[model samples]
Target chain A: MLRIEGLTAEVDGKPILKGIDLEVPAGEVHAIMGPNGSGKSTLSYVLAGREGYEVTGGSATLNGVDLLGMEPEERAAAGVFLAFQYPVELPGVGNANFLRTALNAIRRGKGESELDAMQFLKLARARLKELQMSEDMLKRGVNVGFSGGEKKRNEVLQMALLRPSLAILDETDSGLDIDALKIVADGVNALRAPDFSALVITHYQRLLDYIVPDKVHVLMQGRIVQTGGPELAKQLEASGYASVQAAA
Target chain B: MNTVVHSGAEGFLHRFEGLRARLPGQRLAWVQALREAAAEQFRVAGFPTRRVEAWKYTDLRPVSDAAFDEALTILGDGDTLPAPRGERRAVFVDGRFREELSQIEGASFAIGSLAEELPRLEGRLGALARPAEESLVALNTMLFEDGLLVTVPTGVAGGVLELCSLASRSERPSAFHPRHLIRLESGASLTIVEEASGPEDTRYLHNPVFEIELAEGAVLTHARIQREGVKGFQLGTVYARIEAGATYDNFTLNAGARLVRNEIHAVLAGPKSACHMNGAQLLRAGQHADTTTVLDHAAPDCASRQTYKTVLQGKSRGVFQGKIHVHQVAQRTDGYQMNQALLLSPDAEIDSKPQLEIYADDVKCSHGATVGALDADQLFYLRARGIPEAKARSILVEAFLQEAIEGVTDETARAALESAVAGWWEKEAA
Candidate 1:
C-alpha cells in the first residue's frame, strides 16, 4: 500500500535520504535497519510530512495517492502515522482529550461520525488496557512526566486509537526495557491485519523477535543496500552492520 | 497661579476638599487625618506619566486627558449584584458600600464596611495601609468613597468570602475608587474571591485597592478575576503582609478592559512565612494588560514563588514585571520567578522583566524570561496527528497558560479559569 521511487531528501540543506526505493504491500510488516545518520529517522519524518525536510528528488505515494503534496494533517488523515523518536511533553493538554481530538479528525476525514466524550472514553480505556497503560495516565498532561517506556507505550496507544493504514515506528525501542519492548511489540502485533502495514525502524533486531517482519532491509549511507527475510535479521544481529556496510 | 490651563488641577483639588468636608460625618478623627495626609500627598505627586520608570510601558495619557468627574452615588434599584459561588458576599457600587445588596451567610467571621469598623481597628489599618510614594495609592486613599472591611477571627475556617465591586456609569467621565481592608487573625484560615465587573459598553474607570494583614500562623487564599466591561479601565493594587508561619496565595486573571493594571505587593514580615503569586493574562485586539508584583522578604527563612504567563494577539500588549527583594536579615530566603509570553501576531508586544535584588549571602534566587512565538515543530507534530491547525494551536496555547491556572488551590476556581481560557481561545480562533 506504500511506494517510494528513488526518493531523495535533504534536511538543513544536507542530503540525507538518497535514492531510497522501497514498497510495502498490504498485510506485511517491514523492518528498516540502519546505522546512525543512515536517514532512518529522516525517512520516517519525510513520510509523515514534517516541515524543513525538503524533498529534492523522486516521489512517495500511499495507497496510490501523492503523499508529498499534502499537509501533515492531510497526510495523517490519509492514514500515515509516525511514532516520534522522542515524544514531546505537552504540559496542559490532557492525553485523553488530545487523543479524542485526533481520532475524531481522522474519522471525520473518512466520512464517519465523531464520537462524544463518553464514547471516546470507552474506546480510549480499551486501547489503554491493550497497551498496558493505567487510566490515570489519561488524566495527566500528554507525556509530561512519563517514563521512556510509558511514552513509547503511549505512542502505541495513540496508534491503536487512530488506527492508521501505514504506521512508522521511529526508534520506538530506543529506551524501552525488555518488558516494555514486549508490551509495545504485543500492542503492535495485535494491530497486525490484512489491510494494515508498518515500517519498524531500529538499529537492533531485538524488537524483531516480538513482531517478526516479512522483509528486512539494510540501510547504509542514505540508501537501502540489501533486502532479505527474517533470517537476515538474525545474521545482522550476530555479526553487526560492519559486514552489511562492507557488502554495500 | 495661571488659572487658564490649570482648570483640571483646580477641579481635582476642589473634589478633594469636598470629600474632606464629608469625612467627619463618615468616620473618626484618625481616619480623617489619614485622608487629609493622603490628599496632600496626591496633590504633590499627581498622576504618574509615561516617563516614570515603572509606568514606561503603560501610558496614562488617554485616562489623564479625559476629564474625570467625581463618582456620584447611583445605588442599584433594589436589584442585588449576582452573588459569587461562596458563602459571604459583599457588594460595592460606585465606591460606596451597598448594605442592602450584600449578604453574609453562615457564622464564620465578622464582615462590615470600613466606614463603620475603621475606628475600632484604626491602628491596624494604619500599619497595614501605610502611605507610599505611589501617586495612585495616594489618590485612592484620599478620594476613597467606600471600602470593605473583613476580619476572620482566630481559629475560624470554612466557606469563601466574596467581594464584588460593580461600577456603572449614569454620566460620562465618572470614576470609582473602592478600597478594602482584610485582617486574618492568628490561626485563622479563609478564602477570598474578588470579582470586578461593570455594565457592558460603559466607559468608566474602577480604581480599587486592597490591603490584607495576616497574623502569625494565618493562612489565606485570595483570587481576583477581572472581567470588567471592554470600555472600562481598571487600576487595582493589592498589598499583603504575611507574619510568622503564615501563608498567602494569590492568583489574578485579567481578561477584560481596554487597559488594566493589577499590581500586587506581598511582604514576608516574619520568619518561616511563605507567599505564592501566580496569574495569566489573555489579551486580544486593542486590549492592554499588565500584572506587576514585588515580593519583599524581611525576615529569614521566608519563601516566595511567582509565575506569570501572557498570550497576546492582534495589536494587544502585555507586561509582566516581577521583582523579589531579599533584605540582609533574610538569610536562607528562597525566591523563584518566571515570566513567559506568546506573541501570536506581528503587531503584538510583550515586555517581561523578571528581576531579583538580594542582599543576603545565603539565599537562593532565580529569575527567567522568555518571549517567542509558538514552536513550529510542535505545531507540525500536532497537525500531523490529524488535528486541525486551529485546534492544535488552541491546545498548545492552553497548555502554555496551564501552569499558572493550575496553581490555583480551589478546584471550582480552576475550572472557571479553564473555561475562561477556552472562551478566549474560541474568540481567537474565530
Candidate 2:
C-alpha cells in the first residue's frame, strides 16, 4: 500500500505538484493519465526520492513507513522500485554482475543470506527463460547498445528480479513497441498478488488494454481531477486529454 | 653574495661521487666510463624542475627534500618477501637482487643479476637507455647496485618471468635506483610481470629504469604493478625499442605511493612493428600518481596505441601526458591515444595533456583527453538498486578502469593487475 497527502513538490524553485492526494491500497493497480507537463513524471520522481525534486510540503509513505525521510537505497530496501523511462547505460558494468550485486545488497538490507555466483546465474537464467530473453543479455553490459524495446524489457527484467512490493512505472511504455508493451504488461501482470501494488504513469491508454487497472486517475495541473474504473481508460482513448483539460 | 639554486639532483650527485669506486662493474673501463658520464650529466642537470616542459605538471619538492640516506642499508637475509607471481621469479630487496630468493635457475634463456653478468652485457647494457637525455635514467645508470638481466635467444620462447622489487623498512628515508635490462632476439617471445611494493608505513624512494629491446618478429609483454607504501615515492622509467614485425605491449597500474610517476618511451623502429601502452592509476588521500608516455613511429607502417585512466579520491591528484610522434618516412603510421580521469571527490584533481606531432601527411594519428566526475544519473541508478553509496561509487570506479585492464593480453599479468585494483577498492571501502 502507498499513500500521498498534500504532495506539494517543486523543481528548481518552480512548483510542479501543487496539492495532491492519492492512495493505492493493497492488491490494486492504478493508472495515472495526463498530458505533457502535467506533473505525472514529477510525482513519480518525488516518490522515488530522486535529487533535484524537492517535496516542499507533503508526505509520502509505503506500508505506513515515512518514505520521504529515507535515501534512495533505503527506499529501495523498503520495497520500492522505479522503472526509468530512459534506462541509463552503464558502459562497463555487466548485466549479470550488476543484477547479482543489487540482489545481494537488497538481501543484506533485509537480513537474508546473499546468493553465490552459481546460484545467481541459475536464478537469472530461469528468469530470462520466463521473460523470453536471451542468455546473451546477461553477458553484455547493462543497457549498453540495447534498442529501445530491449531497454524496456531490461527494465522489466530488473523489476522481475527485485520483486518490489510497490512498483512505479514512469512512462516505461513511451518508447516500446506493441510487442514489447505486451511483454512488459505481462511481466507486471505476472507479479499480481495480494501484497503487490503498482502506480502506472502513462500518456496514452494503449498499455492499459494489456494490464487493466483497478482504478484510473486523470492528473491535470499537479492535481488529480477525476477518478473512475477501468472503463475510464477506454473513454480517454476515444476522447483526447483536451476534453479532459476543459472539464478539469 | 651569490646563492646556488638547488637542481634537486645534488644529493644523488654527491652520493655518486662517494660510491663510484664501489659500484657494480667498476672493474670494467667501459662500464666505469659510462657511469662517470652519466654522473656528470646528472650533476649538470640535477633533477628536472617544474620549469622544464617535460616536468611541467609534476613538482619534485617531495622527492628533493626527502633527504634520503647516503647509502642503502642492505636488509638481512631473513626478511620476508612477498609470494612469487610465477614459477620463475627474481626477487630484489632494496635494489639488490636476492639470488637465494630467486627461482630462475633452470631457465632456458639467460637470466641473472646484472651485476653478475656484467662481462657478457658490455655492448648491450645502456644501448637502449638514454642517460644523457633523461635525468632519471642518468641517476639510475650512475648508482644502480643490482637488477634483473634477461636475454632470450633467437626463436626461443622465454615464457613468463616475475620480477619482484620489495623495499626494506627503514627508519631513515632511503633511495634506490634499479636498472633492469631485457632483450629478446629475433623471433623470440617473452612476458615480464614486474611488481614493486613495500610496507604501508615505510617512507622510501624507488626509482627504477627499464631498458627493453625486441628484435625482428619478437614479442615482449611487460606489465608493471606498483603498490608501493602510502608514504613512499616511486619514479619508474621504461625505454623500449621494437624492431620490424615485433610488438611491445606494456601495462602499468599505479595503485599506491604518496608520489609516483610511471614514464614510458616506446619507438617503432621497423615497418609493421606495433606498440601498445595502457595503464590505470588509483590514487586516494594525499597520493599523487602520474603516467607519461611517448610513442615514436620511426619506420613506415608502424602502429601505436595508448589508453590511460585515472581515478582520484579524497584530496589526491593525478596527471597524464601522452605524445605520439610520426617521422616523415613513417608513411601510413597508425597512432591512437586516449586519456581519461574520474574524480570521486570535489577536492580531487586531474591534469591531462595529449599531444601529436606528425611530419607525414599520410599517417592516421588521433589523441583525446576527458576529465569528469561520476555521472549523477549513473550513481543514482546504482544506488537505487539498494547498493550503498560507497559500494556504488567503487563499482563505477572499477568499471571505468575495466576497459584499459582488458588491453592486457597476458592472463597472469591481467589477473595480477585486476587483484591490485580490487585490493585498492577494499582498502578504500574499509
Candidate 1, CAPRI quality class derived from DockQ: medium
Q: Which candidate is the best by TM-score?
A: 2
Clashing pairs for predicted structure model 1, backbone only: none
Error of 1 at B14 (Å): 4.3
Docking class of 2: high
* Number of the predicted model whose DockQ against the real structure is largest: 2
Q: Write the per-residue lDDT of candidate 1 for residues A45-120, one digit (tens) a residue.
A: 9999988999999999999999999989999999999998898878888988899999999999988999999999
Model 1 chain A: lowest-lDDT 10 consecutive positions = A87-96
- What's candidate 2's DockQ score? 0.81
Best by lDDT: 2
Cα lDDT of model 2 by residue, A16-84, tens digit: 999989999989999999889999999988887889999999889999999998999999999999999
